[model samples]
Structure formats: structure tokens, C-alpha cells
Target chain A: MSPVSTSASRLVYDALKSCGVRLMSALPETWLVHLIGLAEADPDMTLVRLAKEEEGVGISAGAHLAGVKSAMLMQNHGFLASINGIVSCAQLYRIPLLMLVSYRGEFGERDPWQTEGGGVTEDLLRALRIPFARLENPSHVSHRIAKAQTLAHSANKPVALLLCRDLMWEEQT
Target chain B: MRRLDALRAVYSQLEGRIVVTIMGAVAAELQSIGHRPNFFYLQHAMGLASSLGLGIALSRPDRQVVVFDGDGSVLMNLGGLTTLARYRPRNLVHVVFDNESLLSVGGFPTATSTGSDLAGIAAAAGVPRTQTVRSIDEFTHAFDEALAAEDLTTLVAKVEPVGPSAYVTDLSLLENRFQFQRYLKESRTTR
Candidate 1:
């Protein structure tokens, strides 16, 4: 992990904590490794490591039902994989779900395997009518996350904050 | 044994516990028995009730969370079993009704129809406790024990492939969500 990436991860983690996110569900992915690590180390936060991304949807719903704020951290592919739960469970049940998706396969993509899912990430989010915002600049991280969370709670629907490479990765210098 | 009978045998035991039922037959049948504020019928989303229960269990360790799931739904998200095992919330009781078919959406046979052992799979997934019961007596006993214990337990109840006459419930999805959420909040305050 680059120093800048680790710093960015801390900024995002702090922002989530500030929003009163007590629980988080995630599966191991490159961009989210540090964020997951931070969650694991925090005794105040409960980290539910998921076998698949879709399970996080249900986890977040259950958390909301229990009157606890929670978040989901996953790669863009994970967001795509979780469409069923996002639509049927979160949307149908009117649960506010805050998902921080690691945006891969955009503009400067390395791995060919990621491009397919990344390519369709925005289109699918639009199709689902799931409101989303991009988080690329470090300075905008806290404000963007807080606003996304507020929208999710107010609308009682699934909202996404895409963690772009600019925010998640620092050029290897 | 029939699914309704299995549910009925354990109905009284579910009084104070938070219950989450999967979509379709399980939800419909549970509703037929009677409705409770603590019950959340996860309507459209199949195969994620266990995950939901896990979240509730973890969030409210003071409350017991029980998930009523189906074989088809379980098979749809087998990875959930492993995730449940990973967390191992002591307050969670996962009860899978294996009817060997998707009784809600026509009579399409599921993987369990051939020879998939859900209990065996759950044990392999590292859930603290697991059991498979074929008779109502066995199911009731296992359920009672699971509720009594503080370990995460997965009970697979084998039942006949039969469902209620209708799958519709009078409760809307949003209504159920609010009712359940309100129940959780009130329960917390009273405690």
C-alpha cells in the first residue's frame, strides 16, 4: 500500500466513523484492504467479513432494522454482484444502505479482468436508479461520504460512493 | 414431516426472539400461523435471510435472532453459510426447511432433491453446531436445544414439498420492516 493510499483510507474510515457507522461488511479487495484493516482494528466498530458481496446488503438491512448505522465496502464487481439484494431487499424494504464501492476498470485500467464489471458499473447504478457520487479527491472524501449517507437515510434507499483510483491508489513513486 | 407442522411445533418458542423468514412459502406459512411485530418477512430477496439474521444477532447480542430459510434459498447463497460460520454469533439460530423443491415458485426440484445435505454442509462450513431432523419431534427437539444454547446452531429440517394454498400476505414489505424495526427499538427501551 502506498503512503498516500493509506492516508486516503484513514480519511475515509474517519469519515464513516463520524457518520456513526458502527458496523461494516466487506470482502477482501485490493483498494479496500486498508479500510478493512482499519475496521478490524477498531474495537468500537464491528466488521462482518463477507463470503460474497451480496450478503453485505442483507447485513446492512439488518443493521438498519436494529437501529444501527452500517456500511458496505467492496469492489465495483461486488456492487454489480449485489444488485439482486440491493434492489429486492434494500429498495423493496426501504432500508437505507450506504455502500462504498472501489471503482476499478475506469480510465486507467491495468487488469483486463476488471474492465468488464467496471465498464458497466455506472450504467447499472443508473439503471437501478441508485443515486451515486464519485470520491476521487481526498479533500472531498469526508463531505461526499457524509452527504451520501444523509441521502441514503433520507431517501431510505441504496446509495453508492464510488472510491476511484485517484482516491484509493497513489502512483508508485 | 410437513413444513407447517415443523413451524407450529416451535411457534411458541419464538415468542421473544427476533424472527426473519425468507420469501415465498416460508413467509406465507409463518404469516398464516399468526403475525408478530418482531417477525420480518424478507419478501423479495431470496437466500439472504441468514445473512440478515446474522446482522441482527451481531448488532443486538442481547436479543436472539432466528432465521427461517428454505433449501432453495440456502442453495442460492451457499456462501452465506460460510459467512455465518465466520462470524459465529451466539444469538443466531439458522433453521433451514429442506423440502427438496421450490414449493413457492412451482414445484421445481432443488439440489436437495437429489442428495445435498444442508446440515453436513453447514458443519463443514464451521458453524459451531448443526443438525438434520426429519420428524417433527426431532425438529422441535433440535430447535428447543438451539434456542436454549448460546452457540450458533444450524438446524436443517426435512419436510414434505408442500406449501400453503396462497403465497400472498396482507402485510406490505415496508409495513413489515417498520413494524419489526419498531419492535426492536421498543424492546431495547423496555429492557
Candidate 2:
């Protein structure tokens, strides 16, 4: 029995690949563990393990400059931490950045520390003017990811897809 | 050595390489020398120049990526050093101009002012090659070697805490980005 939501993780990873995301930068988090593992094992992909989340912003921007499609994978807390980079670098420079954020600490969240960040995630995204969508249903994962990536590139702005608990949790019965 | 003089010493060597300079004196001074399509002056990003360079290096393995950073910016994101070492792109060169102060913002001292050895830190962080130079000759030598070698290198140059008089540039952020992307695309096709 695996701890991660294996089927959902595969769905998200395949969607990213279909969207031509060859490079991914991430910092370790529980919800993103399986996705990160999949990225690491894929030889065709480049996985940059960042020490902090904001670094991924710069990495994605650089990849954009070099004509490589890239994405950033992190938790909601990481998204909050990376707001500075997102605003100052990505937005100011108009880089097309795709961010896949694990929406932790919403409903059914047991961790007290994660709740504050989760609570403010959508509000902050709104404040920043970064359009985002929630991936709560497994059936909507692929289309949402593809749409978000297209929006990012077409609009030349930072767009996010929030991976909700319903789409990223596996219940053991 | 003066920052501008050191830049002049190696300006020609940067002809074909992709250069990413942090926001401040380094970008202004480099632009004053000459602006090229391959040069991306990261205007507002203070501490992510190295990360940007790493991305370009990893994405375009055929091209060499050089980052011009400052003491304050590098100190702000020391974790960047560890990340660079972890991947260790062969075509990446990180050059930190250790003026020991945030010269562009104000004459405030940074961690390097009290003897934080950036080259030593990078070496400890597992970067394959690292060097510290104080003179223009040494800087040029180390930079030339770093660019020529097939391994990741971090070169920290100690200099006086001084910068250009003004921080203005005519190039807009969007314009620079498009020009850079176009340059990369054209160069790839030409090669």
C-alpha cells in the first residue's frame, strides 16, 4: 500500500508532460512527494530540487528565456513564501510561469501549521492578480492543468493550479 | 580593483556566452560598456540571478551561462549556492563581485564585510570549482579558466565598495526579455 495518491499523481504528471513541461523545480512537501519522485525518475525531464520556493520562480523565468517549458511544484506554504519572486521577477518581467501548488490545510486538514497558509492562499492569489483554479476532482485534473499551462504561455503571466486534498489523498480502508 | 575596470577586462570574453546580471551596479556598468541581445539584466530580482543562470544552463546545455552577482544579493540567498552545487551544470559560471556592501541601495555592510568567504562557502557547498581573486589580472585569469572548463565554477572577487553614479537603463524589462529570447532562438538555428 502506497502512502501517496498514486493514480492522481500519475494523472497530474501525464498532464504536465502533455503540456511540454520538461523542467520542474520543487521543494519537498508531503503532498508533492510522489510528484517529485515521478519527476526525478523520468530521464526526459529535469528536476531541480530547490532549497527554497522562490528560487523556482527564477528557474522558471530562466527556462522561459532559453525556450524551455518549465513548471514549479510546491505546497501552499511554499506559494506564500514565493510571492516576492512572483511579483517582482515573474510579473515585472512578464515571464510565462506555470505553478502547480498542492493545496494543503483546507478542509480535512489535520496539521495546524498548514491551515493559516491554506486559508489565505486564494485571497493572496487574488490580491496578486494571478489567476488560478482548483483541481479537486480527478476527472478535471488533466484539462485544468492543460488550460492553466496554455493560459500561462498565451497570457505571458504566472498561472497556478491548486492540487486539492480530494485529488491528492488516498484513503486506506 | 574597480568594478567597472574589472568588467572591462573581461567584456570581450563574454561575447558569445549568455550573461545574467543582478539588479544594480553590475547591470548598469555592464550596460554602460555595451548591451547585447544575449545579456539579460535582471532589473528587480535581487538574489535570484544565480538561479536564473542555472536554469538557462540546464535548459540549454550547448550554451555557456554566466551570472554576475553581488555580495549582498548572494548573501540574501545563500541556499542558491547549495542548489547550484547539487546540479552542477558544466556550462555555468557564477561570479560574485564582493564589494562587501549594498552599494546600489546604500553603503550598508553585508555579511561579507566581516569576512564571509563566498568562495569557501561555495566549495564547502560542494561546487566543483571555486576561486577568490582581488586583482583584475587574477579575476580575468579565473574567469577565463572557469568559462573554458567543463565544470561549474564560482569566482568571488573582492573589490572596494563602490558603484556607478546612476542605476538607470533605457532598456525596459519586457524588451530585454524578448530580445534575449530572440537571440537564443536565432543562435540555436544558426548554430
Candidate 1 residue-wise lDDT at B115: 92
Q: Could you tell me how far off, in angstroms, the CA of residue B140 lies in candidate 1 after the best superposition?
A: 1.0
| lDDT by residue (tens digit), candidate 1, A103-131 | 99997778899888888999999999999
Clash totals for all models, in order?
Answer: 0, 0
iRMSD in angstroms, per model: 0.6, 0.7
Q: Candidate 2 on A1-173: residue-level lDDT in tens? A: 66569889999999999999999999989888889999999999999999999999999999998989999999988998898899989999999999999998898887888878888999999999999999988999999999999999899999999999888987554
Our model 2 lands, by Cα RMSD against the true structure, at 1.0
Docking class of 1: high
Q: Local distance difference test, per candidate?
A: 0.92, 0.92
Which residue window of length 10 is worst by lDDT in model 2 chain B? B102-111
Q: Give all candidate RMSDs, comma-separated.
A: 1.1, 1.0
Of candidate 1 chain B, the 10-residue stretch with the lowest lDDT total is: B166-175
Q: How far does residue A158 in candidate 1 sit from its true spot (Å)? A: 0.7
Task: Give candidate 2 misplaced runs (Cα > 4 Å).
Answer: none
